[model samples]
Target: MGDTEPRLDRGEALAATGVGCFLWVPATGQLILDPVGRDALDLLPGEYRGLAEDLRPKILRDDWTLLSGLSAALRGGLKDAYSAYFRVALHDGRSRWTHVRGNVVRDGSDGVTRVVGVVRDATLDLSPSSLRPPADEDSDHLHTLGEAAIALARAMSVREVGAVLGDELCLRRLGVKAMSLAVLEQGRLRLVRSVLSLDDAEPPQKSRLADSWPLNDVVRSARPLFFTSVPDFLDRYPRLAPHQHGFHATAAAFLPLVEQGQPLGAMGMFYENTNSFSLADHTLMTAWSRAVARALHRVTMLDRSREIAAGLQNAMLPRRIPETPGGRITVRYRTARQGVRVGGDWYDAVTLPDGGVGVAIGDVQGHDTEAAALMGQLRVAMTAYAAEGHPCEWVLAKASAFLAELGADRFATCQYLRIALATGAVHAANAGHPLPLLRRTDGTVDRLELAGGPPLGLPADWDLTPYSPTSARLDPGETLLLYSDGLVERPGEDIDRGLARLSAAFSAGPADLEELADHLLDTLTPGPHAEDDAALLMLRRDAA
Candidate 1:
């Protein structure tokens, strides 16, 4: 009887403050709510002691959907505490905004056993703004946060993530006046983006991590720092007094971007009208920071992966083309713009045993690491066969057999040719490769028609037709071009038309082989979003 009197007094005290407590046990599906909580949820005194499911009909359907995930977040052990703003339907046929802030009690295995929290009526706190409707302002604010998260998830680079955060529309949606993001690199903070309203003045692009700036302090401590006013910020960090004009905000919040227990960087948000952050605002900002951190980590990993792929691809290509005394030889290799930046397009200029220059250009079946590996092996085999004094046709045949023997379930298109340095004589063979362009001394370009066989790696019985050889002569001041299909393939376009365009460009190109190679790339290459690898090899016999 003595304990009951103290409990009653405590409940009365909580009711007077308009804050009510709730205890929920997930295992037994039991819920207990105090008088204030029951009144806010529109539940009768007797109805408050029932199961949690019995109160579902009192919540707005969309709000229930939004708040229901809190349980999963606790059960999965992903979050220890959460704050949610949702709508509840009252018996008077009207909706009231309710705010709940709770902490989970986890058992030994980290499963949520119980939840203890406070509930309050939040309808009066939903302020009207130009960006949202008055009736569902809180819901619209949450929608804006969801949109930002979706945009961040698709961001491919750190700069892209900053762009999403700094977009003016996104800022307006979230009622923020300005935003900034910085990344940590080698003990320094490199500012990625900043959208301040100050004219002709902004913070430095880079700062030492040990500096006394709010961003640096937040990163070092892995905590959030909020300033309610300019004076408050200056009082805490007096060293930044000189740069106060650059911020120009009444309030600001700096959050650390930490992933996997490592501090990656920090994000800063400035507000004009806000004098202080409410509990709801603080919770939302913290959650948003976590989403931004995850996105930054993901993009950084992708950047590293692309770098590694590009390095491997460059290492496999020829470091230098053999100096051909007969004529000038120029080559260029470009990675795809849209994907992994690695592919199987390769070019080789090998000095043959008979003092002739042997050149081969080929593209493997795919644009992945396995294709690149296969291309390396095939190039080595072809170069070796040419050095052993094999004919152009025989070299292609041996390459095909080598690819088939690997059982890689892939194929490649190749063009191999041997040219006599002194005589300008050419013997060429093709395997499902594009036709080479021959430019006459008069600057007229025409495709050299040649018999072709299937691409390499075909079954022995499938390639009964031999790879036939074609003979051609290179005259003085004339060029012969070999290129990958990427140079002529376009989406929603005909390859023949692209080939015709290339022929025109080649005919009008400069006499210098090096300059001509550049001309072809500058004129014939696709836009920045080209999705296939391209390789080019050009040889021009010296004028007699």
Candidate 2:
């Protein structure tokens, strides 16, 4: 009691108790202040003062327990904690904004310590200030737009660029309620990407305003529009009244995604509650839209480039059959339908110096430009080796070695067949390929089974010897069919079933090689779409 004997005055008593500047009065349920000036305390509005009075009793009884209760109440509701400014609006017409600091102070008698904290009245300066200069917000907007443009430029496809733009607008800290990107396809706007909520939450509902909202107006006019309030905007454009319900009832801005007077699409930002979009927000969004347009253009160019490259690669494959003396050889090659359209399936036939013909069919491991280029190299090498009069096995062995060296362990499947017109014999060697079909004139089919060899490009340590050449007589009225796996195989279908189907289709069809090849290409491939590339090479012997 000797330490500045407790004063009778509520304020002085709080000060003497050394419980910091603010003390909760249990009896009156109000905060009794000490030496801190009234200006700091005066920052609280009357309603919040009443709230402090109501909360004082709970705080004095439980201390920090009351803080947890308050935080739980404000979790996802309208509450904000920015820098040092924390504000929360209670159900009652009361709002609280506080500046707090704390430290540990020891109790003199027990030599034990407790944390002593102070809640100061620093609310007077809590209002948000405009840090953006007159046009500074515009500059910031341009900067963000530049970032979006760069992302789009670096994107490999249109869908990729669309993803980048959607993420930027929908994943940033601005709490954007919804966003979308549309492309002008065949004179109609097609939605490419749609994103909702800048926060990690379910996306809010959205409507396409391209037909009746201000977005369509902006896009059609190639101008940007900012709406501070939805009610007023809806009054002017009553047709959009129905779509303005829900979260779209809040303030918004529409910016046309355009470049060089051509409109690619539009970008929009929606809020949850009624408020006006600032001029800075509009400028920033407009710049972002422009950047997005540039990105879309770049993506378009990349798609065109890929298409041209794919077309050129397709042309690199053989177009027509090369006329040979004993029989006819027809080739068909289809490229992959999706992803990189580089076709790895290839077929080649060259007349040898020794009056024999060399034929090769192969498939590389991937569907990309690299795979197509490797196929080209292998085709040329096989033709050159076969024209040199090397035996079929020797050609494949040397080619396999060359591929192993060139590919550094990359692998491919190939089957090479050499036909000697003078001897009426066909010699073939297969490297991990399906057995070729021999169609006899009597509607009988035979599979020319050769011992399997290691795929081309396997290391030399592997047993390449297992793939020795097999020989068969090329009797009159027989057709030899060699093809890539895509011809008779499909997902979920057994390989035996595919082979049986191919054999039946060939046996049931006309004897014309062209007709048979067409039937196989048309009926053997599943569905209307070819999931993978298919290559076919047919060689027939003249009827005696």
Candidate 3:
């Protein structure tokens, strides 16, 4: 009772000062409201006993979804502060925009007992020109954070989580032009991911924590340090100034990445132009670090998980193209960088018992471990079916049924090719996959159009409607290109543009099968990680 008196008095003090004070008790799952708290939420004083009972009705209907999540975040069990903003429906047929800022209070066992926070009017702050920016930006930020959480939750490895961080936090969205992420692995600092302009300067010969000073110091002190200007940084760490040559960063900040007070890593963000960070900017960066640290810790453990997954996938994927009399069978596979997933893309080439070469390229739906596993199973299934001397159409039809029975939930697109090594005859079937290209002896490229069938795993039942394979003739010195959609498909773009790019690449590509494979792969992969995994398999008939 004595403790309750001071809390009530503090609430009165908050109301007297034009701010509202709120106390959320997890035991009852209720918010105790003071006079200003009621006014801030557009409620009558003493009209509500607890938040859960009276709050939902008062909240604007369209904003209920935001409110529900915000309630969790505001009471969000985090070691850091939680904040949210939303509009409340008023009695006078009006709405009030309010911002709630608070921290969760937990008992000795780390169980949240209560949440204490402040509330204030913040409608004007929602404008972009306002000091606080708009709630839309806040909403986007929250949405990205939610996505990061989801990515980490289902991540196959730490690298997948790292990919999420790079996608979310890279670039200057948060005034970070460059970022370096590193963690202590077995008493050695292992660089997780670094996006910086180091120019020709080599990496530090040693990778021990003691080798990097300010970074190591922050990890030890458990605090963030910032340098507002390049000269300021150079002046403080004179011994480290010489290494700055060609590494011209104007401003820098370092944060000790931690999880529940345990040191996990150290992260640094840099700016190219001279600048100073505002207090608000510092606060936001700190919050981002806390979130990133949790994700990165898991990435550190994913080394073996990724290795095993990669080994399994690599084993399932073809190692080399089989020798064929028609010409040479060349293939290339590139997984997306940053480890989004091992990928569901697979390519295989095998010599048939009938003196024909069977080449298959497929992309299983999804970008996770399950997708990779399913991709392996389906690839093996296709190889086995094709080996049994089945027609192209039969292989796909049987595969569709096989995956359905194998409990495959994701869909996949595949292309199968049977090339008669002696006659240069091509029989191809596309299972809702991309078209194959035929590069002529005259340097002209055309699509080998085929009747498309359903992808693997669909209808929750089965859709192996009998479909016929297509036929095309591969003349001497002519090439047939089989590729996965990742080579041509991108978001917000037409597939034709990618096809045209492929055509242009083939026209200008080397006549040699091996060089052609590398040339095409290098031309399309614009970033370190292709937007998705890309597979290229090219075959040409021998003129001799």
Cα lDDT tens digits for candidate 2, 1-544: 4778654787665444432354432112244443442233333434345323343332222122214212221111132221122333334534445454433332224322222345544335332222122334555555655655655555556676655644423223333544666666655555555432233222222334446545556767787777777667778777555443233436666778777777776766654443755667665666566667787876676677667766866776766556788777887766544344666788888888878788888888877778888888887887788889998888988888888889544689999989976566988898998888888889788988877787887888865565688888878778888899877665554566567667766776667888778767655652323457789898887775
The list of candidate 1 runs beyond 4 A from truth reads 1-136, 166-168, 185-188, 194-208, 231-250, 272-284, 336-342, 353-356, 420-425, 437-446, 473-481, 487-530, 540-544
Model 2 residue pairs with clashes:
none
Consecutive 10-residue window with the lowest summed lDDT within model 1: 127-136
lDDT tens string, model 3, 20-43? 888875333467876677787887
After TM-score superposition, what is the CA distance of residue 381 in candidate 2 from its true location, in Å?
1.0
Candidate 1 lDDT over 31-125, as tens digits, reads 88877888878897655556675677887653443453364344233576877777688888677778888887655243325679999887566
Q: Write down the lDDT of every candidate, Cα atoms only.
A: 0.78, 0.62, 0.69
Number of the top-ranking candidate, with TM-score as the measure: 1
Ranking by lDDT: 1, 3, 2
Give each model a TM-score.
Answer: 0.63, 0.46, 0.54
Best by lDDT: 1
Task: Pick out the ten consecutive residues of candidate 2 with the lowest summed lDDT.
Answer: 74-83
lDDT: worst 10-residue window of model 3: 127-136
